[model samples]
Target: MTHDLLRLATAGSVDDGKSTLVGRLLYDTKSVLADQLDAVERVSRERGLDGADLALLTDGLRAEREQGITIDVAYRYFSTATRSYVLADTPGHVQYTRNMVTGASTAELALILVDARHGVVEQTRRHLAVTGLLGVRHVAVAVNKMDLVDWDRSRYDDIVADARALAARFDIEDVVAVPLSALLGDNVVERSAHTPWYDGPTLLEHLEAVPVGTDPATQPFRFPVQVVVRPQAGEYRDYRGYAGRITAGVVRVGDEVAVLPGGRTTRVVGIDLGRGDGTVTELSEAFAPQSVTLRLADDIDISRGDLLADPGRPGHVTRSVGGTVCVLSERPVRPRDRVLLRAGTRTVRAMVEEIIDQLDIDTVDYRRAPQELRLNDIGRVRVRLADDLPIDDYHELRRSGAFLLIDDADGATLAAGMADAPDRYAGADI
Candidate 1:
């Protein structure tokens, strides 16, 4: 049987043992290599430790190891009998919150660590807010350092309550809390005897069992044209095709599709799948995430950056957009700043018209009308687009709704933005 894949990200405040927890999970799962284990053991003895410092497994950078902190995103891959996993271990410092956003953007699940003694700190709340805004459907809270608290159930309960209440504000649905000591490897991969009252599954068990992804057939069809395929010397020399990976839903021959940015309608006459071995497979139907070349009934002007979607559910074509943005660069973005907005296959010019508000990580509230958004700041903004974009709300289609702000001068990514629904932008002045 083919194994399903799960993508997850880890976040926490400084000293919350996020790295140690990830190391513990990998170690207990037997995902570490023998050479890597030997290096960790040697390093642990140099530090005068009794056992291997599991945190060393993930804190790979020389600067990170010297400072005993995670400064950048570290990715790890492992597999079990039933499932495969991709883990992004992000930094925990408030200054590195931008790194956290990058890590959580594509995560289906977020594993947040809270120090048992600290409960929920400001950084913990910040991580939760990012997880919710990024649309991560599932969350697993690890109340670390349970050994320090002597397995006190009340401490664990209090932290879980705080996390759930905060998550509710963001509309997060599924939350599961587990009390574990990463340093001693309790309740991570194996059950620990210290918590006889706790009957929940171990951290790894929860990760393996959580549901992921939806049925592509039930979603709206969205395909962005990546390339126009035409061979000059082939037997069928006059053939023309639009090639791209279906981002959502399914498409079949005879289905009418809307080519966006131009509002042209066409029918799918053929679907061709490339086998990557210099061969092609013709199909009557294809569903998302599959890359296929499509032949249209009529020769309409189409090229890269155009979208082919189900006519009934083709997204909104708009010039003004409002949504939340997470600033990632050192340069602050303010009103009248012109930047490039890259959404899927299209890149367009956009001007920031307003800075709606900036989130206060401490109070978990919005500060209305901030002057500018700096590094690691989350805020609301409106942009005036140079061209029409058939965009969807982040909640409706994640691939279609998310965008990036790039420095027009050098192409450096300035921020990540998630668009609100079309109704939400009614009466907006851009």
Candidate 2:
């Protein structure tokens, strides 16, 4: 069988050793080059450390190195005999929540690191909330720095229980808790003999085994138009094609599709994957993931930012989107505020019709009827998209289920929201 690639995000609070865990995974899998190891070792010696500082492998910027903090989402790739992996080492600092969002947007799983001594802190909960909201299905909670806590099993169990409780509130069902010390490399790559009471697999072992990217053959077809392909200068002048990644499901020659929002349906006359003859015809077969140009049977006004969906199972979307929002900026998100509502490929001007509620993550309850949303405050807001976008509930397709709000004037990327169905989450009082 072909070894599949798994994309995951590493998350936790500062000092939880997210970087070290990532480094250990890369190092153990024999992915680190000699030059990279030498660089980290040289830096470790300058800092007066006894061994190479594996965290140095990720904290790329000078500011990050000097402050001993991660400021950006560092991407690292590694592969074992069983599977290949792309790791997104996300920021641990509380203020860098935006980076976490970016890192986790494409992750199928999240490896959450926590200090065994600190147990469950606010930052841990925050990261978990973000992961859940992002629709990550699998979680491997690595309780790091366990040596500092004397590798106590009771401490590990307590943290595990607390994390499971938190995971429950956000609809994360497949959570695997493991104990590890990233600094000491316990249960990260090699199973540690020091922790005799623990029996779970190492973080590396679990990652190698957890399934990612189920076959999209069963999902409903969706293609978000990225750029309209019209090479006006060449012989392809008359060729009009919709270019985008297939978010889910299948598409093949002669299959009927609908141009979302416009609702003009067409048939897929050709499918090109950008290489080799690249035209797969046979409406019955499932087309895999690849950037392809889809030529429709009819040219009924389709362009970029339009949705191409399977006519059989068009996205059951709501006209009015209600969702929980977190104002990342210091500015407040007041009621009736107007912002751009982007769902999937389509972006529409939307109004903040109402503030239905605010969520206090610590208490797991909603503050019903909050007047305004402050920075980092999670609340329920209703935004009516200027036009209906073909989108599924966040619970359906994570890729098409959420959107980013862009400021009209300065083009600032504002809050990220999980789009709930229309008028559906009004009772999300928490």
Candidate 3:
């Protein structure tokens, strides 16, 4: 039985022990098999290590096999008596910022590792800013290599203070700090007797007890119809459903709904829930975060990329949008740049209307009227869609509102943007 599930992601600078932290969580939780542990032990000895190497457990790709580093996102699943965890261990290099976005999308908490000797670096601040932008409410800061710093309270407190200041700039609500030696297994899973000055919870303790929930049933129902299910086999010839995941809210039987882009009105007739083994329908109330087959009261011009939302809670539709941008490619983004806009499950043609400003992270200076956004540079811009499309404000609903800019020729994702009110949010330094 799936009692409770918490999706989490791990991020930090390269060689800051993100993979090692994931390995520690799995090893101490007894999620790794004997054969896997034996193989890791053999490889550790071959590499001339003093003890078993846990980072080898997650660096599983052939490219990583040759480079000895994680180049893509690695997902790990484990369970305890209280809850189940879906851990997305993402690459930490500045070049792999795109992979971090893929992992942080659905995560409720972020684990940011910091080197005890380095205090706070630029990469650390970058990762923190993304987590805050993605709306992950909880964070765990692991001050690693404590043995190298002699487990000193002064060193640990200094790093904690720096991280706290960064979190404050992002306005993150929750923070937990743990002093550990990932290479030596100090305070990762079981609490270590090394830091008597630290009285806070261990890494796993915080994860196990963290409150994580993003429910659509409570807010408003938004079902972006992905497929029109019309089974024409056996006795199911009359079956029909608008298939898609619930992006924001809920859709229940007899609830009034609006189909957008086509602007059709109807009521939900029935719902069928799939349980992996077989499909089940409770036939009454269906809420957000639940993927099910929805039957409508009337047939309309609904198709893929169409939206199903609450009649009164429909999203804002506009031909133009404005938000902050971070150009991730080597080529700079300039005015009138042509790109494809991906909003939720819908894709539309769009063009870069203007570059309003550029951000200097080192000095926090937002320069006015920048010409282009270079690689790893943050800026503000305006985008004009070819046709009017519905997108929600990021502060209002994350899943229903965020968008990405993709290169039409090579299909490379260039930028990630969230919709805000006209002229962008007044306080969106994120």
Best by lDDT: 1
Winning candidate number (TM-score): 1
Error of 3 at 152 (Å): 1.5
Error of 1 at 122 (Å): 0.9
Better of 2 and 3 by TM-score: 2
Of models 1 and 3, which has the larger lDDT? 1
- Local accuracy of candidate 3 as per-residue lDDT tens digits, 1-430: 4469899999999878888888988998999999999999998899898888899888878688578678898899988878899999999888887678778878889999999988888878888877876777888999998989899999999999989888877678798889998887888888889988888888888888898786655687788888899868888888888888887776779899988866678999998887877766555877767788899989777888888888797877788888766666777788898999888788899999988787666554568877788776667788999976777877678887788888988998888776766645566653
lDDT value, residue 343 of candidate 3:
85
Native-to-model Cα distance after best TM-score fit, residue 205 in candidate 1, in Å: 0.9
**Model 3, residue 163: displacement in angstroms?**
0.9
| Candidate 3 ranges with C-alpha deviation above 4 Å | 62-66, 230-238, 274-282, 328-331, 423-430
Worst 10 residues of 2 by lDDT: 279-288
Collision pairs in model 1: none
Per-residue lDDT over 1-430 for candidate 2, one digit per residue giving the tens place of the 0 to 100 score: 6789999998889988888888887777889999999999999998899998888888889999999899888889899887888889989988887778888888999989888888889888888888888889899999899889888988999999999999989899999998888888889889999888888899888998898895787888888999888758677788777888888888878789988877788888877666567644323343546667788888678777888888878876556877766677666777777788777678888888888888776786677887787766677777777777777777777777777766766767668787776546446433
